[model samples]
Target: MKPNLSLRVSQHLALTPQLQQSIRLLQLSTLELAQEVEQMLDENPFLELSSDDGAPEPDPQAPADATYSEATNADQISAGDENDVETPAVDTPDDWEGDGSMDAAVEDGEWGGDGTVRSGSGADEDEADAADLARSHESLTDYLHRQALSLRLSELDRAALRFLIESLNDDGYLEDTLESLAVGLAGADDAEQLDELVHRFTVALGLLQSLEPTGVGARDLAECLTLQLHAMNLHEEGDPAVVEAALRICRQPLDLLAKRDLRRLSQLCATGEEDTRQAMALIARLEPRPGRRFADVERNAIVPDVIVRKTGRGAQQSFSVQLNPDVMPRLRVHDIYASALRGGRGGEGHQALQARLQEARWFIKNIQQRFDTILRVSRAIVERQKNFFVHGELAMRPMVLREIADELGLHESTISRVTTAKYMATPQGTFELKYFFGSGLGTETGGNASSTAVRALIKQFVAAEDARKPLSDNQIAEMLKEQGIECARRTVAKYREALKIAPANLRKAL
Candidate 1:
């Protein structure tokens, strides 16, 4: 076996560097893609952002009309790779335009037949600036510290309060017990020192809870609610009897309140049914998360990769999908650098510089391909789920990655990558691209109902149900059955939970 030698021929797929880059760029969210572009621009001398005025001036060192010579080279390189993985073509239909500008009329449900889509430029600009300003807001800790400055306290008390403020979680709840906090602070096993630290923490805790947001230093939900109730009582914000009843209810197990167990709450709070109901209602108005407003807005901000606008009216209704110009990076090969490289042939480090130029070209090509694929996929989604845009989530049709993948001559994994982390802005609201694809449930008409639509229906039923006697999952299921959808009670419950709706028992009013 050691001396054996034979000729063999085998074929296996391999992702080329450009192909890998294309795949990677396709999957990245708008923010991530922008970061990648920034990195490429920094590393490659040949790569630069294209001008808003259109193509750069023609390079004198190069042939006439060769301002974007690298673009042609890129096309040639990509075209010559016959055996490489299929990349989405940039040639799109006239209807499926990628020109960043959108028409104002399209948003008003009227297509002027120019095939152009434009949002309210002035309004969007102001809104974007406001959003950017909003995202730059201070963190919860910073906000608390700002309020702390107005306090007149000894250094020790101030330090303790600062420590407690920093210890609070994003939700404004102090997750650690004062004993543990004191132990951590004392950093010793001495009992007396620990007690002194705990006392300071307790004093600090009271002061911290009295902050502007209220309930900032609470250790648990009950404590947070109690603190807010006490504040309300002190301020005479609500009826005295109701506030007192709420305080009493907060002392009992929270599960009773969550379940809306009026009898149990009345028994535990020692209040009349009417008073308990009012107390529960009062508690509902209180903010459970005091620091939620201060949470980092930038982290949660979603920059959609595609924008879909409603076009036409009545019987001629249509959707115009376009790549979000804001998210798409305007990238190109540096004309001066590429011209210098082209003219100074066989110079020192010529090969390395040429490789970088090629890389820059590939980067631009891949970026173009990425947006093209996204546009294609988005158009397919809009075509299939057009009803969803017009009629909302209830009219969402059952769809899968394979359908779009097949229609676009792409692999299912590519479709998945396109959808993940990528969002689309539609009249219905911005949603992830994956939101359009959902598993189907069988219906009596031998058709399929999207699970998303089913979830939407469940939400509607819950919304419309009588508060005194909310519809149970079984009742929801029965209602769906009557509506030609064959959904199980468990499925309804699952969808309800997914929608974050409470159970019937919990949803019931006193």
Candidate 2:
């Protein structure tokens, strides 16, 4: 048999750089995207925060404008694409008059619409502003450097300390190997001096964990909690029941402890039910992941992509949906740079330069496509779940990716991508774009309730239940049936778990 040499033509989809970026940006949580953007800004000269324009102008009463810009900037920057992404324009407050101001404001707020931010000025305002600024947090590295200065160390030792501090991750763990630390510092001096410098890191590590939130500089979850417990003076003498229980709990899988298995835990700790419960309670207070706090606090604030407002006509009500403008990034490539590249001014690196330019352009274009897709998906949600806007989660109808995809005349995968990690702020609360899409639970009467609505209803039942006999998953399922939402006890348990609610026994009162 001869190998075929004849060419046969067929088309296949290729993952372009821009498309890849869109997929990545879509899936990234707001915090991850912010970090990625910060890193990108460092690597790309052309890419910068929209506010790198200037220190934001001072405003005393311009809450509306400030809110507007913040929301708009978040939308654009967070969307992560440059081309074809249309930022919905903000409506000036001037258009909204008298009682309309607050009504408009509430409407905007409900839908996460762009509006001016409230400002502070004057002596009183300055004091208020200072109080507000006090909440601003320092980076982990900055805090470590400040703490390190108080330690009495030689110049060489201090240098090593700084290196080790820098190497500590957000959780306060020494992620870098000592060998790598030595290599990194070797450039400053000879191998002998570098080894001495690296040896000094142990002292720094001990001190780093000793800082606020303890256990931050720990090597892992065990060390982090242990360090924190030690710092808190919670770790005590041998057979100190609380300390032993805490240690035992931490040593095992955190999930088992999270379940608060009173019986199993009592057996493990060689204690009675009361002692086991107490130990479990104490262990619950310990931070499982110390770094999560830093990552969460530093995360970018939510900027909704769409807003829906209720407008009434006579006895009838409807929703007015608007896309948020604040998160949009208004960017354009430098004309001079583009022209220079076209004129062959890049010389030897022209190919690389052109490639980068193409990437940037593609990035911008992909962002535009992302916005277009989001808009279509969001609109579909608004249309199908209009009842939800009018009457809250209780009125939310069953919806899924296929329903939206069919409505928008797009693929389910496309709908899935658009919904991934995207958020919408509503009167109900801030929810993932996907939250509005839920499977249906068929009712006895041949109708269906959204699984989301069922979850919400279940939560309401649990929250309002008697603590002495807190509603179990089985009980909750029964309650849902009373409300005409037919669901099983296991399904109730699943939803309860998803809401981070403990089991019936654990949720019960003392």
TM-score of each: 0.82, 0.59
| lDDT computed for candidate 2 | 0.61
Q: Could you tell me the TM-score of candidate 1?
A: 0.82
Model 1 lDDT tens row, 154-181? 9999999999999999999999999998
Candidate 1 segments exceeding 4 Å error: 51-54, 58-130, 136-139, 177-186, 189-200, 269-274, 343-348
Per-residue lDDT tens digits for candidate 2, residues 1-510, read 988788888755544344457666655654555576567656654333334343343223224542335445445433322232353432324432211101112221222111212111112223233223435867777777887788888786677677777777766677776767777756755878777766787766666666666667777776676665565455453336666566666677666665666677667767778766666666557776665555534244565666555556657665544455445444333445555666686466887876665555444444444554566577668778877876888888888788877765555776776788788766676678988888899887889888988888988888898988988777788888887778999899898899888888878754
Worst 10 residues of 2 by lDDT: 97-106
Number of clashing residue pairs in every model? 4, 30
Error of 1 at 208 (Å): 1.5
Clashing pairs in 1: 102-117, 102-118, 103-117, 103-118
The deviation in Å at residue 385 for candidate 1 is: 1.9
